[model samples]
Target chain A: MISKSVAQFVRSLHQKKYRQQEGCFLVEGAKSVQEVLSSTFEVDLLLTTDAFYKENADGADRQRCRIETATAEELTRVGTLESNNAALAVVRMRANVPLLRAPDAWVLVLDDIRDPGNLGTILRIADWYGIDTILCSETTADVYNPKVISASKGSFTRVNWWYGDLTGVLNQANAPVYGAFLDGDDVHQSPFNAAGGYIVMGNEANGIGPNITPFVTQRITIPRYGDAESLNVGIATAVILDNLRRVQG
Target chain B: MISKSVAQFVRSLHQKKYRQQEGCFLVEGAKSVQEVLSSTFEVDLLLTTDAFYKENADGADRQRCRIETATAEELTRVGTLESNNAALAVVRMRANVPLLRAPDAWVLVLDDIRDPGNLGTILRIADWYGIDTILCSETTADVYNPKVISASKGSFTRVNWWYGDLTGVLNQANAPVYGAFLDGDDVHQSPFNAAGGYIVMGNEANGIGPNITPFVTQRITIPRYGDAESLNVGIATAVILDNLRRVQG
Candidate 1:
């Protein structure tokens, strides 16, 4: 049975203030929860449907994962998303923004990416393409945001995210920093071409924020022949990564 | 000033039945509304914040857009999406999904692709890369879904979309049909493949649906060294397009 105080506490996580106060954020769905439990992330609590707990609890024996069987309705009530998931967990946040070990390599830097789904999707892309580290600016959505966590599928477990000033970081970087722009040299051909550099993607509605623009060695654009005003950030990154990597790959 | 009945009518388009009955769908925001006004797609109605209409009405004259000015409150009452915009347009549905006119070259087929944003983003990718036609299986979400329209960023203006039995379509194609599957041959090693073929992408959660499997000549898989379970459909498509296209300016 979920106590009223527990219910209130779980509901409070929707706001950033409450999440910081608790030092935790919510994760939902069986797949994501299982992925987190298997990783280095510390699962403080795992509330799941009794059927779900019975189905997959043994092999995923994480002593830190304290499983509490609950009804679907109860899980739904605490869920931060529109969909009711089979499992839910409150995991401690990874507060450290570790220095990217190999900074010269292809590191994706997100500037003010506010949408959790977009942020999460971006992480999954990074994982798929074998990008080891991602640096997100301060205004980018929190990595622990529920929507971001869900959209990331399970990629967040392996992907490290941090809140830092992208402008400052890129300015001091040893290699090229490519910022996507509306009118830049074709990404297919640019001199900032090194084995690895920072590929900076900006916010959804806005291009590269002013703070980071000056630091970019080349403002690159995906060759667009059609009438689209701009590609979705996730799509644009994929296009750039595919093109840039093909030349080097 | 928007009337009560009109607001209700506009808001009703959120429901599939209402959209079907009216033979129209909603497109909102400055970019979306502007795209519909500029495109050949017939605009049944237009509602915008007076401030926007006054500033941007000149362009509407070129497209012969029928403009209706509404208060923020009225737009709020009528808008289907969470974020209200400066403008909204009711575009008459493109009821016909025509067979591929240029099926001789590379084509895209979506087998139950569900996400609106993914579908829209895919359409935009198709437009940018010069994939003239995309065939959608019956289960795929409607291309006109407002979320899809908004996410496309106006790429829907060019790409031709059709819904039908994907198997039948594949059977008719003269070239080898390719399907992207986890079990398929590594896409990287696959040599100068067939020129004209239907490239099938599957649903969001599930890979390719069963019906379309038997008809494919080749299965392609993206090599992944990271922990991500799957790539976003839009990303996967862009990656494939980059690989297949004759890469030169």
Candidate 2:
């Protein structure tokens, strides 16, 4: 049984300001909660159904976090998901540490990508392409947003992200910076960096910001065959990464 | 000024049953309303701001639909979009007629794409790849769903779709049927049909339904380099279409 205060605390994390004040965010549903239990991130508290608790008690105990058994209805009421039958974890956020680019490995950079769903999907796409590190401009959606966490499908645990001023990082870049643009070298024909580099994606409505555009060493376009105005940024990312992997292989 | 009855009628189209019973769907936002006005699809009614009505009065006149000048707030109140400042169109639903495959052009088949947003994004992707025809399973989300219309941008105007039994269509397919699967020929290395054929995408959670699996002449897989359990249906669709276009070229 969950106390009134604990339930309210969990509910409060739904808002960004509360999450920031608490330095914790929610990971809902069975799969994501299970994933967070195994990851290195600290879980402050976990509220779960009896069945979930029984199946995952060992993992939950290892996290050294307080665990409370609650009804599925109770779990759903406190969580962001429509119907979370299994679990929800209030996990602590990681520090805004700088991530170094690994040798011969691609790094994804986000410039003011404001949508939470898009950000989360991009994280999952990055995980699919084995791009582990991501750099985000401060204007990008908060990594700790529950929508982002849910959409990532637990990929948030595997991928590392750093949010800061993108211009400073791009200006001092030692490797090539590739940006997605409407009029640029065709991604299918353009040769990518053999040693890997920074791949920057911009805002949903606007392309890359003016501050970062000058730092791009290469501009790439996904050729359009039909009359659609533009591709969804997450879809564009996946296509670009798929092509990148194909050429690298 | 919009009347109360008209507002009630527009709001009712948000549900599928109402849309079917009335044989009309809502097209919200400035761009989509404009596109639907210009498309062959008939517009039954149009609610627009005075500013929008002035800008596109000729096109609105050409649609031969009843035009009501309403405030942006009124449009927003009755529409699915949070802020529809320009226009909202009540469009007549097209007949569920069969679409013939254009020779040497690919056709997309969806088994049970349940998410309205995913369905809309797929339509956009199909438009981007020049795949104009789509066949949908009965269980698929209704194409006229407001979320689908909004997510599709304006691609819903360009792409043609038919909803019916997958079994009948696949049994009579004249060309190769390519189904996306987990274990199959690597899409990158696989030789595609020189002449375009049917490319089938399945349900979001379930890859391909058993009913449609047997009809697939060739099973294709997008090779995953990292740890994502599966790609989102829309992302998968884009990736597959991109590869198909690249190889065909």
Candidate 3:
């Protein structure tokens, strides 16, 4: 059973301020919890239902991560998920943002991606396409937002994110800076060299902001052939990334 | 100004059962409202703030839909959206399911897409790729759900959907069925004939259900290069469609 103080401490992590202040954020569900355990992230606390640990005994033993028991009701209180997932954890948030100068490959630079799910999906897309860095403008939703953490399916561990001025970072990106827009060049037929660069995705309602738009070297778009006015930002990101990766003479 | 009874009526549409019972659904924001008004879907009412109407008079005129003026406060009370978008409309649900024939053009068959955003993205994807017909399983999220409607960004008008037994519909799609799965053939190298067949997407947690699994004639997946476990379903759909469209050679 979770004590009142423990529950209070866990719930506080829901806020961006609280998560930053403590240098810890929460991840829930068996998949994410297990991924964190196996990855480089340090687990502050490991809370799981007894039934969950028993079923995956071998994986649990190899993890050697801390184990704490919770009844079904206790699991219900701590988990940020809509339903009571099998496990939840308080993992230390990486404190520093790595510099963007050394880009061996692509990094995603998001300009105010407000939706947590979209931001997370972008991170996952970056992971799938071998892009290892994510630089978020201050206006972007907090990376540690639980919904993003869950949507990423633990790709957050592999990708490094820095929250700062997008203009400053674009200046640092020596290679081409590509932006997704309505009238941009067709991504399907565009020439995207794979040396290294930043792929900028913009706000859901608005495309890339005027502040960073000037720095963009290539304006590209996933061409729409049907009647929908716009594709969801996440889908557009994947379409663009997938196409960019497959570009070959 | 909305009367007490009118406010109560508007608020009720927030629920799926209520939207179903009244045979009407809500659309918000300038673009979505305009799209619904312009489409064959009937508009029961259009609610807006005064400022919105003045600024968007041209769009409103083009739509020529009915109108109602309300304070922003009144909109919040009746709206399902968290954002205070300029307009909202109650559109008559087009319960008309298009004829269930094997589409000669590409069609997306969703076995059990649960996320409103994913379903909406899929709807938008269908629009981007010109796949107009989407057949949903009974378990999929209602396309009329405000999130799904909002996420489609007005693509809902172009895409026709039917919620029924998925396999039955797949039976009609005798040409070919491409199912997305982890163990499927690499979509990059696969020959996905565009001779009007079905491309099936699975549930978020579980892929195609057992009932629908057997109906898939070909299983194809977007090959992943990173440690990320999988791609988001909507992203998978876009990637697959984009590749298939490219691999048409």
Candidate 4:
């Protein structure tokens, strides 16, 4: 049986304030926990059921962290996921080191993406399109938030993110900045001749902010054939990346 | 103020069984409630705050439904949304009449899409891409579920959906069937020459089921350039539709 204080500690990481105070965040579910154990991130503590421990003991044994056996009920009680039959891990947060855009490679820039789920989904999209680096505005949802971690499914391990002022990065950028806008040049027809650059996505309710808009070298739009007021920020990101890859090929 | 009995009745629609029993579902927030009031769908009851009523009194007046003035707190207390400051409406569920495929138009087919948010996001994607009709398996999340309605962001009013046996529909379908598979033809290079057909999407964990597999005339994939295992079903759907529209143009 797990102690009450330990459970309380794990549960505290669910909120951003506690996660910041502790400098660690919770990674719940079997897949995410396994990814974190295998990743470079330091695991502070791991709570796992007997079945999960048995199945992934090799990976768990390799990690330099405290491992405790717990029931599925205990995991569900202390975790943010609706049901977690496998494991939950307390992982040390990485320093927000600036992510440099590699030579001839694409990067994603997020501006004030407030929803945790949207932020996580964007991370997954970035992973899918092979965009390894992400730059986020300070107002964007905390990447360590449990909701963001849960929604990312294990993509959080693959994508590197830095939360800072977007203006400073955009202003210093040497590559072209393409921002998603409603009335900009059609993405399908836009000549993406540049080897690699930055693809900037904006807030859910608001498009790109004024501060970031001027730094945008080009404004791109996914032409709408129907009447949706707008596409979800995550969906728009995927479409933009897909089109960008298609043109580069 | 909404009566206790009426509040209880509206809350009952949150569940599928009661929604089925009463032949009604709830649409929350100002935008969705307004969309329901203006749509062809019948509205049974509408609960609105004074601000929303004042701003949208004309739209509310146009509906042939019971309109009761309630405080924002009462609306939030009675509704599923976390903070509903505007309105909520009890809307009659549409009859599950099979949606006829329009000539030279693509239709979406969903197989066991269990998540309401994914289903709703797909609906919005369809609305954005101009794919108006969707055919879903019976196991798919209820289209009238509040989560689906909220995630759809009023796209439910514009798009049409029918849920039933997938095999029966696919077996009788004359149009080409394209199923999203991990190892299918690269969507970037695939020749989407068909005038109009079906784009089939599967469950979160499972691809298209065995029953629906045989009907797929063309197997397509969104080529992954990175190490992420798979795309979310909704994201995949948007990517496919965007490519389809690009090629068709």
What are the per-residue Cα lDDT tens digits for candidate 1 across A31-93?
887787788888888788877777767634654466677777888887876666477888888
Q: Model-by-model lDDT, in order? A: 0.79, 0.93, 0.81, 0.91
What ranking of all candidate models by lDDT puts the best one first?
A: 2, 4, 3, 1
Q: Give lDDT tens digits, candidate 2, residues B104-204.
A: 98999999999999999999999999889999999999999999999999999999999999899989989999998988888888458998899999998
| TM-score, chain A, candidate 4 | 0.98
Clashing pairs in 3: B104-B196
Winner by TM-score between candidate 4 and candidate 1: 4
Give the clash count for model 3.
1
Q: Indicate the DockQ of the complex predicted as candidate 2.
A: 0.83
How far off is residue B127 in model 1, in Å? 1.7
Task: For model 2, name the residue pairs that clash.
Answer: none
> Fnat per model, in the order given?
0.67, 0.73, 0.77, 0.79
What's the CA error at residue A33 for candidate 2, in Å? 0.8
Query: CA shift at A165, candidate 4, in angstroms?
Result: 1.1
TM-score, per-candidate, Cα-based: 0.93, 0.99, 0.92, 0.98
> On a 0 to 100 scale, what is the lDDT of residue B175 in model 2?
96
| Deviation from native of the Cα of residue B35 in model 4, angstroms | 1.6
Q: Write the per-residue lDDT of candidate 2 for residues A11-125, one digit (tens) a residue.
A: 9999999999999999999999999999998999999899999999988999999989999999998888999999999999998999989889899999999999999999999
lDDT of model 2 at residue B189? 82
Better of 1 and 3 by lDDT: 3
CA deviation > 4 Å runs, candidate 2: none
